[model samples]
Target: MAIELETETADGDDFVVYNHVAPPLSELDMQVIKSVPPGGNWADIPLSIAQKSKRIMQIRKSGGRTTYYGRLRNDLPSYTVSTYFYRPGNGSFVHPEQDRMISVREAARLQSFFDEHRFLGPASSQYKQVGNAVPPLLGRAVGVTIPSGFAVDLFCGAGGLSHGLR
Candidate 1:
């Protein structure tokens, strides 16, 4: 069977989509996904114990911040950032690893957002947007099933699946 799908980009660009059938995730991928916490990154764990870590360089110093280079909300300084241990239940303001919450860019990368994707607004706003976005990789996995039959996306937000479908 074949199916046609429509996707729209954040900028409102439209495209048609199709896909081929593929097997479900293997045991290893499932295990990895299961092991990883939601919105968590390697930095969530202690540096001495973490398997991976990422550093985010801010565009401007926090004291004299410019809109173009500050952290997503301009409230925090640029420094080492990771989502290795972030969890919604742990509270909104606590850092998943260090004493500060993860930055917007850090959250975005964990959610599979490409570095090239420019986010709009302040640091906190960006973090909220990135945190709320669906992981693009997961959306791509779902898109792989489009060619086999009709696909429905429940709780679609910002159309990540639609982007993947294309």
Candidate 2:
């Protein structure tokens, strides 16, 4: 599996997608992603169909993790975006509509990262940056409670609180 960026005018959203790229994926990876439905996971794939995959077959034998090969649910909140989001086998990373992993920008959006906060690195590093981020939205939520005081930020995780408080 790999992370590939695709750009489109985000409909009814504040973000514009661009700087698209790909990490490259094998045919098997694409097939597995295509097999999942919105809100579906590895269990949705029949054993007969996924048999060609050693990992998938092993998952079947061991009983699957809910996060494994999961697709996003359009109507629901997203699951946590971990560093493993780049791979379909690792988390609920598949796009709700497209038969591919969610792009870096999309994952950033999930983390409430603004469009201007560009990630500068290889595709894997970009994915890592987005996945490990502490969302500005969450920080903003915390900031809301402080009312007014000497805000002392002790733990800095990408200046999320500072961004939100700004």
Candidate 3:
């Protein structure tokens, strides 16, 4: 979710600026957020909690890939956004310092959205939009490298590449 930014109007009038609202996280999710450190993951969680968690048990039983509870590093670009980013076990979608999953607005910024680009939808839908979006920075770099005037996007969910070209 987006945070509010205070700003004044150009005509020297008082105005509340950059209105934003983030969905609140649940208590359990908050606990997990506080326990995990930047760039850390489920590995960083206390052994007691980790062992007791159902996700861990399922991972051990299945032997499938389990990088769940991955955290992000503030100093570097984050890992690719995944479709199921709300689930910590899905990808490195946690906030670097905040004890929570990165907000929808934060995810959007990572994908090269300016603060003005407001996402309109329920929290889950907003997340899906951000997760599916191409990183605008990557799109710009690739678009410039490509030697074509006309561009065609087969499944442009959020138009990151199209925005870059524009």
lDDT of 2 by residue, 76-134 (tens): 99999998787889989888987777777788888998766788878878887887888
Worst 10 residues of 3 by lDDT: 15-24
Model 1, which residues run further than 4 Å from truth? Answer: 1-97, 148-166
Error of 3 at 105 (Å): 1.1
Query: Native-vs-model 1 lDDT?
Result: 0.40
Judged by lDDT, which candidate is best?
2
Q: What ranking emerges by lDDT with the best candidate at the front?
A: 2, 3, 1
Against the true structure, whose TM-score is highest? 2
By summed lDDT, the worst window of 10 consecutive residues in model 1 runs over 53-62
lDDT of 1 at 121: 66
lDDT of 1 by residue, 95-151 (tens): 323323344445555567765576776544555566566778879987896787665
lDDT of 3: 0.68
After superposition on all C-alphas, the RMSD of every candidate to the true structure, in Å, is 20.2, 6.8, 7.3
Better of 1 and 2 by TM-score: 2
Q: After superposition, how far is residue 130 of candidate 3 from its true place, in Å?
A: 0.9
Candidate 3: stretches off by over 4 Å: 1-23, 60-67, 148-166
Candidate 2 Cα outliers beyond 4 Å, as residue runs: 1-16, 147-166
